[model samples]
Target chain A: MQLITVAGPPSSGKTSVILKLIEAMQIAASDVGVVKFDCLTSFDHLRYEERGIRVETGFSGKLCPDHFFVSNIEAAVEWGQNAGFKYLITESAGLCNRCSPYIHGIMAICVIDNLAGINTPRKIGPMLKMADIVVVTKGDIVSQAEREVFAFNIRQVNTAVQVIFVNGINGQGATILASHAAKARSIQTLRDLKLRFTTPAAVCSYCTGEIRIGNEYQMGTMKRMEFKKP
Target chain B: MNDTDILYMVLTVPVGEIMEKHPVCQNFFKNLRIEDIERGLPLHQALEKADPETLSEFGLDRHAIQREFCDFLNVFAGRSDATGPEITSITIIGGHGKAGDPENCQITINRGETISIVGPTGSGKSRLLADIECLANCDTPTGRKVLIDEQNLDDERRIELQGRLVAQLSQNMNFVIDLTVNDFLKMHAGSRHSINIDDTVERCFVCANSLAGEAFGLDTRLTQLSGGQSRALMIADTAFMSTSPIVLIDEIENAGIDRRQAIELLASRDKIVFISTHDPLLALGANRRLIIKNGRISRVITTSEEEKACLSEIERLDARLFQIRKKLRNGEIISRNALG
Candidate 1:
């Protein structure tokens, strides 16, 4: 099955983009399954179910949703295959800006809204940088000039990635996305698919449930943030 | 020569050479005794007759000194220096919370009870967990007051006994350290003053494997571990090694480990468990569920027997999903019939 990972910041229209793509794929006679990964609770699965699509939801309560998604990805793929689906689409919880849920040899899409800000592309970590396609959502709300500038900022960070402007509410540009996903080459050898970007190094003591605050007892990969004097 | 000359020569001779030259000298060196060529008593008897002060000056108490050294070594190796506090319960008083409505709420959680907080995103479910972690006394944004055994805990004591009072497991379980799994556990075990470090490390491994889908060896670097494995390791370490009386879990549903087993492990240890989650399985698993809205506690619902019964159905569905996931990871094609 063709696996597509949809990731972006919260309320960046990831779900809307996926929904529109699913609709377009359905019209083209493609069977698809969805796995929604959220940090706490999610109602996205219900929407998929209402459409009579096979869907499963995972809540990564105290765990990073990306990590949770990777752990259960195989199970999701199996579920998709069991249902004879042509595509398996996953929606990740956009909690950690630094984390990238994309895997190698898969169609990785990162959705961002024009309203998020033009510089959002620069601020977003690897999720936007490593995506194969950057889908600009809420394009209908922004002026053509604003859309151009947002697209330009995205290209500045990732020169090779394809940028697609989509209005998920009315299914604009979804046909192109669905066709690209449906016709994309399947991964030749899934044996050693690695993530496109390295996960941000986990150096903070908080990462390990450490409660003490001090430099002496701290151990691990640590980063210090510096504030410039105004 | 006189007897004094003989005595002086015996005392001046190096002990090693003297023992080698005169095998009898090995036992008789306690004090100098002139050889009476023909009438001298045996060396052993001669040493017995020597003065105690002379023996002491000759450094003949080597055996006693060696014994003391061994005793000191034992003391150094056998003692456990680590200690932790034993808390019985955690009580939340009717302090005003900083969420949807500014209302006072009170809840007392005893050891071995599991409580879950549920709310929409940005609704303050996490705020309550934070208040408890900080041992708030209406001073923080949430205006929640936390007590240990129905007594207010001071800030100094809280700082002094941070990890002992509560161990929080947040959503991120990333390891920044480059050490191997074996080294990481060893460091934790040493800090905790574990009596049997090797045994504790082994137990942690077994427990982590039980919760994680994939098995990782002790030699695997912490950075190389998958997300689920890291979470599993932390959970096992907290449940088994940490002496904390309360465990605050941000969410474990997406951690890729066995969420149910992890919860059961912590609760079985008599820890007062507070989990903030949006998952139904976790919410229903708790004895009581606190609903959070806007940033305050709106209602508290005790899990009904009907919900408990529904949990089994949920578990079954979860297991089915897990099985399918496993098969897919193994590079097998899934068929509709396989789901059955």
Candidate 2:
């Protein structure tokens, strides 16, 4: 039930970071699952067919984005893990940083495109402060001085957070960022361990329509549960 | 368990493309307070940006909206609900270039109900069903007004509500993909929102096969199903919906199912059920019967001594007419019963 959410501004390499992570995981023989909590994008579900990823876009008449992302991201992560994915990468909607790191205890990676300049950090100050990893994407587009200043300012807001440059085209600096992310813990996964509804009557805390009253393994480890009860 | 959803298993469909293909869906969006395409909101954020003021202003009721939307979608391929009808009105602005008798017509089944809409072929019986489903799903008459319990349904919410509150069973029950009986039930159950799966599955088995889950041995595709089995399967699917309160059934008699069993199922429920048929058995069983003649609800009989007598006489005349038509087709001369 661990969820690692990838957050960033639109067109700033958030999708790229997740795709690369998935590729590296597959290359390393690790099964990874990915889901997108999109706010402004729409497409056919089959686009994810090649990778075996399942997408569940938020429907109209449901709640707002902030609430949907946190809840839906949690559901997707749980579903993937149950399906035996070794890791789960969630791509968050751009322009919605208020609830970016708000997911209860997952490592949040904020992609800051260096080519976009220093103002990028200022526009996303709150997200950077909450991020566990601040990736300076499009590193080739920025001067070394600009990278240093960017990291320096980012480190000031969250001194313990890791900052690195990523040249997605050449695979430069991605290894370091990936390694840091690998060690980060997921709060949802940790909290999930405390669940002890020893009976068949124990409804899932995440999705109430499904209840776990006994020891059984479903196709997707996570039981198919509906949020809206009949 | 939340890990899988986080991994972004996407179920995205091009909203604009689908909306374009099914313009009536745009009406569903309009009902949600977004009338113009310029709002250009993506499907994921449609509910978020839905104008609350517009929904209220339109005076749309929530339950009806949910039911009608679900009803419309149930008409698609592999999505029949067979549960019965939910619509109150299906007003065609102009008949498909056929000379029009009525501009708008309403077909409704009220609460505590059993009812049927009866008509001759080309009398708009099937057309009425299709139009009702189109209106429910926001599919036809692009941007037209089709009300459920009198509240207007727009396209966005209509699609959202379609599966949850209304289910339909079309006449031509055919499938391209072969599936076992259980597979058919399971696929449909997954799409709906609120039913206890185990309980619903159990009930479905009982109704479908007239036996419990383990005892029901038949498991085959639509092509293999006898008229009775196919009709029963559809009925089970519709009756099982925890979402649709209004079930629209189009000519249950066409499948050669046991009419008594179907009637019993509808009679047992409190929800509205509308069935369109030519069978006298179904027509007489209805709580209300609307005789659609020449594409209009020419007469409605809820219950009066004279109305009851008139219906019985009409049924008699209908049976005689059917025999006469059959004999004439065979080139036989008219009999005394035919003349009467």
What's the DockQ for every one of the candidates?
0.01, 0.01
Cα TM-score per model: 0.46, 0.36
| Candidate 2: RMSD to truth | 25.6
The reply for model 2, stretches above 4 Å from the true place, is A1-230, B1-108, B136-145, B154-165, B175-177, B193-195, B211-223, B303-340
CAPRI-style grade of the A/B interface in model 2: incorrect
* lDDT digits (tens) for residues A33-89 of candidate 1: 788888888887777777777778889886666667667777777777777777788
Tens digits of lDDT, candidate 2, A1-230: 34576767767877666655554333332365667666655452354445566555553123345456544554676677676766677766544433343443567788877766543464454466567778777754432223444554454344456676655654444444555556657443443432111111222342333355544522233434458876
lDDT of 2 at A224: 47
Per-residue error for B120 in candidate 1, Å, reads: 0.8
Tens digit per residue, CA lDDT, model 1, B1-340? 2444434434454434434543323212221222222124323333444455433432234343223222322222233434446677787764554433565578888999999999988887765765675566665555667788778777566544432366667664345546788887876665455778899899988999999999999999877988899889888888777767788888778777899889999999787889999778888999999888767787889999999999999988888888888899999899997777
Instruction: Report the C-alpha lDDT of model 2 over B200-303, residue by residue, as the tens digit.
Output: 66677678675111123336664566655666766765565433465567665645455656665755665466788777767776767766666555666775
Runs of candidate 1 exceeding 4 Å displacement:
A1-230, B1-83, B97-100, B154-159
Backbone clashes, each candidate: 16, 53
